[model samples]
Target: MIVAILGAGPAGMSCANACLSFGLKPVVIERGDHLGGAQRSNFHPNLWMLGFPGETGEQMTTRLAAHYRELPVTTHYRAEVTRVAASGDGFLLTLAGAEGVRTLSVQAIVLATGTRPRATPALERFAAECPRAIIGPLSDSIRDDIRDTDVLILGGGDNALDHALFLAERGNRAVVCTRARFSARKPFIATCRARGDIELREHCARPELGHGNERVTAAWANEQRAFDWLLVMYGYLPNTDVLAAFDPAIRPALSAGGYLHVDAWQRSGVPGIYAAGDITDTPQPSVPTAMAQGLTAARAAERDLVKS
Candidate 1:
C-alpha cells in the first residue's frame, strides 16, 4: 500500500522508515529542499538517540537524511501542497511548485507539515517593514549578521526564554517583555533568570516595534528603547492551511491551536487520514516525540489497511 506523507522532516522521515519496515511503499514530500525543517537550524547538540553524545541537531538530521536515502522511499522536494480534497476511497492532493501543478491520489496521508513561529499582533504592523528584525523559530536566516546586538524579545513562554538565553550567551543583550508569568518549565525559567545579561521585563504592556533606517527600533510605554534588533520569542503554529479544502468532518479533528487532534495510534477522527509531529496535538513537542508519533502512525496505517 502507498502512504503519502506531507513533509520530509524528522517525523515524516521516521514515518517513511516505519512504512518501509512494514513492507509498504512511502512517498515523502517536502516544501523545502532539505529534509530537516527547524531541526537543521537548531543550535542544540545531542538528540534522544540512546547514549550518543555531542551530536548537534544538524548532525542528527543529516544522519536521518542519510538513512532515508538508503530506503526505497520516493521523495519530492520543493513541492508546495495547495489543497487536499476527499476522493472516493481516499484523498487527492493538489500541489503547485517547481514541478508545476499536479494531483496525486493516496489511500492514507500523514499530515506532518510541522509548525512555524507565530507572529504577535502587537508588532504585526512593523514586521513587513522591518523583516530583518523579526526572528522566528526554525529561521536563523539573519542571526549571524546581528551578533552582539541589543534585542527586545516579546513573550513569556518556553520559546521566549530559550531565545533570551541563547541571545545572552551569544554576547547579545536580550530584554524579554511579557505581561504574564513565564509559561516555560522551571528549569528553563531558572536558567534564564539566573543570567545577569538577560533582563526580564515582567508586566510589560503594549510593546511595539518601529521601523527606521531599514531596521527595527523598540517602542514601548510612551518611550523608545534603544535597541539594534528585535527578537520576538512567541510560540509556533501548525501549517494546516492545505487542509482547508478537506471535508467538514476533517475540520473538527483539529484542536483550537490548529494542531490535528489524533488518538494513541496517530489516527485523526477522519478516516484514512493521520497526523504526526508538531502538527498533532501532542503534550510535548520535540524531535524524539515526533519520531515516535511517526512510527505509531505508520504502524496504525499498516493495521488499518489490512483490516480494510
Candidate 2:
C-alpha cells in the first residue's frame, strides 16, 4: 500500500516511518524546501521532547532530518498538492513542484499540514505597513532584532504570555491585551503577573492603530500609547484551507473552528483519509502528541487496508 503524507513535520515524518514498519510505501510531500515545518522557526528549547532536554527546535530538526534521510520513503520538497480526488478505494493527488506537475495514487492520505497564526485584515494591513509589527510565535530573527524596546502584544494564550516573559527578560517592557480572561497555563499566567515589566489587561479589544515618531500608536481603553513594536500573537488556526482544493464531494469533515475532525483511531469522516498533528482538533497540541497521533493514524490505515 502507498500512503501519502502531506507535510514534513514531526507528525508527517513519524507517520511515514510507521507506514514503513507496516511494509507500506510512504511519500512525504512538503511545501518548503526544508523538513522541520514550523519547528525551524522555533528557537526556544523544547521541553516536551523527552530525553532531548534543552535541545532547541533547530537542533531537534537536525536529528529528525538525519534519521529521516536514512529511511526508504520517497520525499518531495518544495511541492504543493494542487488537487485530490477519489479513486478506486484510494485517492489521486496532483502535485506541483520544481519538476512541474505530476500525479500519485495512494491507498491512504495523512494530513499534517499543521497550523498558522490567526490574523485579521487590520492586523495584516498593519504588518504590511509597519516594519516593526510582528505576528505569530517568537522566532530567531524576532529575538535577535528586538531588544530593550516597548512591545504591545495581543492575545491571552500561552504564546502571548511566553513572549511577554521572554521580552521582559531582555529588558523590554510588554503590554499584553486580550478580549477575555487568560487561557494560558497557570504557571505562565502567574509568572507574567509577578513580572514588573509586563502589563496584563483582560477584556481588551483590538486597538486603533496609528503612527507617531516612527513608533506604532495603539489607542484603546481610553488611552493612547506608542510602542516600538506590535506583536499580534492571537494563537493559531489549523491549515485546512487545502481541503477546499479537493473535490467537495470527497472532503473530510472539519470542526466549526476550522480544524480537522478525527476519531480516536485518527480516521477522518471520509474513507482512506486521516489527519494528525496540529491540523486535527486535539485538545492539547504539542510535539509529543503530534508524533503519537501520527503513529496512530498510520497504524489505523495499515490495519484498515489489510482488512479490506
Candidate 3:
C-alpha cells in the first residue's frame, strides 16, 4: 500500500524507514528546502539517539537525512501538503510545490508536520520590518548575524535556556527575560545561573517594545533597554493545519495544547490517519518519542494495510 508521510523530521523519516522495511511504498513531503524539521536548527546536543556519540540535534538529523535518502522512498522537497481529505478506502492529498497543484491518493497518512513557534504580539508587530531582528527556538536562523549583538530572549522553558546558551556561546550578549520563574530542567536552570555572558531575569510582566528599524529600539524592564534582536521562545504550536480540511466527522482529536491525540501505536483514531512527534499529545516533546512514534505508527499502518 502506498502511504504519504507529511514531514521529514525524525518521526517522518522513521515512518518512511519502517514503511520501506515492511515493503510498503512511502512518499515523503517536506515544505522546507531542507529536511530534519526543527531539529535542524536546535543547538543543543541530543543524548538519546543511539550510536552517534555527542551529536547535536542537527548532526543527528543530518545522519538521519543521509540514511533516509539511501532508502527506497519518494521525496518531494519544497512541497507543501495544502489539503487532506478522506477518500473511499484511503486518503487524498493536495500539494502545491515543484509540480504546482496536484492531488494524490494513498492508503494511509502519517502527519509529522512537527511544530511552529508560538507567535507573540511583540514579535509579530515588527516581523516584516526586521526579519533578521528576531527568531524563535531555531536560534541559528539569526546566529551569524547576531554575533556581538545584544539580543533579548523571552521565555522560561528549557529551549529558552538553550537559546540563551547558544547565543552566548556565539559571542552575542544573551539576555533571557521571563515573566515568571523558570520551568526548565534543573541542569538547564543551573547552567543558566552559572553563565557569564547570559543574564537571567524573572518577574517581568511582559516585554514592552519600542519601535526600531530592526524591530525594537528599546524594551522596558526597569528602564529603557535596547537590543538589536528579540528572540522569543514562547513555546511551540502544532502544524496540523492540513487536518483542518479533513471531513468534520473524521477530524483527528486534538489535545489542550493543540497536539494530535494519538494512541500508543500513533493512530489518530481516524483510520488511515496517524500522528507523531511534536504534533502528538505528549507531556514533554523529545526526539526519541518522535522516532519511536514514527516507527510504531508505520508498523501499525503496515498491519492495517495487510488486513485490508
Candidate 4:
C-alpha cells in the first residue's frame, strides 16, 4: 500500500516512519524546503519532548532530519498538493513543485499540514503597514533584534502568556490584552502576575494601532500605550485549506474552528483519509501528541489496507 503524507512536520515524519515499519510505501509531501514545520523557528527548549531534555526545537529538527534521511521513504520538498480526487478506492493527487506539476496515486492519505497563527483583518492591515508589528512569537523576524524593548501582546492563551515570560527574560517589558478572561495556564497566569514588567488586561476590544518612527501606539478602551513592537498571539488555526482541492463530498468534516474531525485511530470518517497533529481538533496540541496521532493513523491505514 502507498500512503501519501501531506506535510514534513513531526506528525508527517512519524507517519512515514510508521508506514515503513508496516511495509507500506510512504511518500511524504512538504510545502516547505525542509522538515519540522513551525518547530524550526522555536528557539526555546521543548520540555514536552521526552528523552530530549534541554534540546531546542532547532536541535530536535536536526536530529529528526538526520534519522529521516536514512529512511527509504520518498519525499518531495518545496512541493504542494494542488488537487485531489477519488480514484477507485484511493486518491489521485496533483502536485506542483520546482520540477513542475505531476500526479501520484496512493491508497491512503494523511493530512498533517499543521496550523498557523490566527490573525484578524485589523491586525493584518496593521502588520502590513507597520514594521513594528509581529504576528507571533515563534518568528525569526524578532528573534535577536527584539531585546530590551517594550512589547504589546494580544491574547490570553498559553502562547500569549508563555511568550510574555520569554520576552521578560530577554530584558523586555510586555503588556498583554485579551478580549475575554485569561484562559492561559494557571502557572503562566500566576508567573506573569508575579512579574512587575508584565501587565495583563482582560475584556479589551481590538486596539487601535498607529505607528510612528520605531514605535507603535495602541489605544483601547480609554487607555493608550506605546510599545516598540506589537506581537499578536491570538492562537492558531489549522491549515485545512488543502481540503479545497478535493470535492466537497470527499472533504472530511471540520470543527467550527476549521480543524479536521477525527476518531480514536485518526480516521477522518472518510475512508482512505486520515488527519493528525494540529490539523485535527485535539484538545491539547503538542509535539508528542502529534507524533502519536501520526503513528496511529499510519498503522490504521496499514490495517485497513491489509484487510481489503
Candidate 5:
C-alpha cells in the first residue's frame, strides 16, 4: 500500500521509517527546505538543551533524519500539499511547487503537520514598535543581528526558560516576564535561576502599548518599561487545515481545541487516516511522545493493511 505523510518533522519522519520496516511504500512531503522542521535555525549559537536538561532540538532532529535515511522512504522537500480528498479506494493528494502541480493516490494518510505558535496580543503590539519582535516559530530569529539587544521574553514554561537561557548565553540581556509564578520542573527552573544572566519577573502581565506608533517602544505591566526585543513562548496551536477535506463525521472525532484527536494507538476516526505529534490533543506534546505516537500509528496501519 502507498501511504502519504503530510510532514517531515519528527513524527512524520518516524512514521515513514516505521512504514519502511513493514515493507510499505511511504512518501514524505515537507513544506520546508530542511528536514528538522521547527527545530531549524531557531536559536543562537551554543544554546542547546531541553528544559529537562538534555539533548537539543537540532540534535534530536539530526538523529531522526539519520534514521529515516536508513529506511526505504521517499522524501520530497519544498513540497506543499494544497489539497487532499477521499478517492475511490484511497485518497488523492494535490501538491503545488515551482516544478508544477502533481497528484498522487495513496491508500492511507498520516497527518503529522504539527502546530504553529499562537500569537498573543502582547506580541502583536510589541511587533508594531520594534520590527525585530519575534513570536511563534522560533526558526525566524537565528541571525547575528540579535547579538547585543535587550530581550524581554514572556511566559514561564519550559520553552520560555529555554529561550531565556539561550539568549543570555549569547551575551544578550535576557529578562523573563511571567504572568504567574514559574512552575516548571524543579531541576530546569533551578538551572534557569542559576544563570545570573536571566532575571525573573513573576506575576507580571505583558505590557500594553504606550507612547509608540510603529513598534513597541515601551511596555507597562504596572509601570512603563523599555526593551529592544520581545519573545513570546506561550504555546502552540495545531495545524489541521489539510483535514478539512475529510468527512464531517470524522471531523468532530479528530478535533480538540483546534488540535487533532487520536486514540491510544494514534488512529483517528477515519479508518485509513492517522495523526501524531503536536497536532494531536495529547497530554504531553514533547518530541519523544510524538515519535512514539508515530510508531504506534504506523504499526496499527500495517496491521489493518495486512487484514485487508
Candidate 6:
C-alpha cells in the first residue's frame, strides 16, 4: 500500500522507516531544501544537545537523511503538499514542487509537519523595528556576531537560562528578564546567578528598544535599564495546515493549541490518519517522544491495514 508522509524530519523519516520495514511503500515530502525540520542549523546554538554534550542538530539530521537513503522510501525535497482529500477508498495529495505540481494517491497518511517557534508579543514588537532583535529558536542569526555585545534575554525557562549562559560564556554581558516572581527552576536559577557575567531580573517585562535607525540600542524594564541584543525564549506552535483537508470530526480532536489528539497508538480521530512529533497533543514534545510516536503510528497503521 502507498503511504504518504507529510514531512521529512526526524518524525516523518522515522515513520517512513517503520512503514518500509512493514513492507509498505512510503513517500516522504518535505517543504524545506533539507530535512530535520526545526532541528536545522538556523535554530539556537545550544539546542539539539538534549542537555548532554554530543552531536549537533545538523549532524543528527544528516545522519537521519543518510539512514533514510538506505531505505526504500521515496523522498521529495523542497516539495510542499498543498492539499489532501479522500478519494476512492484512499487519499489524494496534491503537491507543489520546484518543478511543478504532482499528485499522489496513498492508502494511509501520516501528519508529521512538526512545529515552528512561537515568538513572544514583546519580541515581535521589538523585531518590527530593530532588525537585530532575535528570538531563541532563531538565535543562530547572531551566534557568530555576539562577541562583545550586551545581550538581553527574556524568560526564566530552560531555554532562557541556556541562552543567557551561552552569551555570558561568550564574554558578552548577559541579563535575564523574567516575569515569574522567582526562577522556574532553582538549580538553573542558582547556576545562572553564580555566573558573575549573567544578571537576573525578576518580575519584569521586555525592555523598550532605544531609538535608532538600525539595531536595538537599549532596553528598559520598569525603572531598570539595559542595552544591545534581545533574545526571547518563548516556545513553539504546531504546524497543522496539512491536516486542514480532514473532516471536521478529526479537526476538533486537535487541542486548542492546534496539536493533533492521538491515542497511545498515535491514531487520530480519522481511521487511516496518524500524527506524530511536536504536532501532537502529547505532554512532552521532545525528540525521543516524537520518534516513539512515529514508530507507534507506523505499527498501528500496518496492523489496521492488515486487519482490513
TM agreement with the true structure for every prediction: 0.91, 0.95, 0.92, 0.96, 0.84, 0.88
Q: Residue 297 CA error for candidate 5 (Å)?
A: 1.3
Q: Show where candidate 5 strays beyond 4 Å.
A: 42-54, 121-129, 137-148, 193-196, 210-216, 247-252
**Clash count, one per candidate:** 1, 0, 0, 0, 4, 0
Question: Rank by TM-score, descending?
Answer: 4, 2, 3, 1, 6, 5
Error of 3 at 190 (Å): 1.8
Show pairs that collide, candidate 4: none
Query: Candidate 2: TM-score?
Result: 0.95
lDDT of 4 at 295: 97
Best candidate, TM-score: 4
Better of 1 and 6 by lDDT: 1
The number of the candidate with the highest lDDT is 4
Model 2 residue 16 distance off true place after TM-score fit, in angstroms: 0.9
Per-residue lDDT tens digits for candidate 5, residues 1-308, read 98898888878888888888877788998877777666655443223234435555666677667877877787888888877777887778888765579998988888888888767675666555556577753455364556766777777877788777767777887788788998666776898788877888888866774433322444564566666667777777788876665556444265647788888878887888888888899887767777788888788788877667
lDDT by residue (tens digit), candidate 4, 273-308: 999999999997888888999999999998989777
Candidate 5 Cα deviation (angstroms), residue 32: 1.7
Clashing residue pairs in candidate 6 are none
Q: Candidate 3 lDDT (Cα, whole model)?
A: 0.82
Candidate 2 weakest ten by summed lDDT: 137-146
Cα lDDT tens digits, model 2, 170-261, are 89999999999999999999999998999999989889988657699999878999999888988888989889868998899998888999
Of the two candidates 3 and 4, the one with more favorable lDDT, higher being better, is: 4
Ranking by lDDT: 4, 2, 3, 1, 6, 5
- 1-308 in candidate 6: lDDT tens per residue? 88888887778989999998887888888888777776766333333336544666666667777887888778888888777777776777888888599889988888898887668676677677676677654445458677877777767787788777767878888877777654456887888889889989887765666645444555454364445777777767788876665655434268776788888998886878888898889886766677778888889889888667
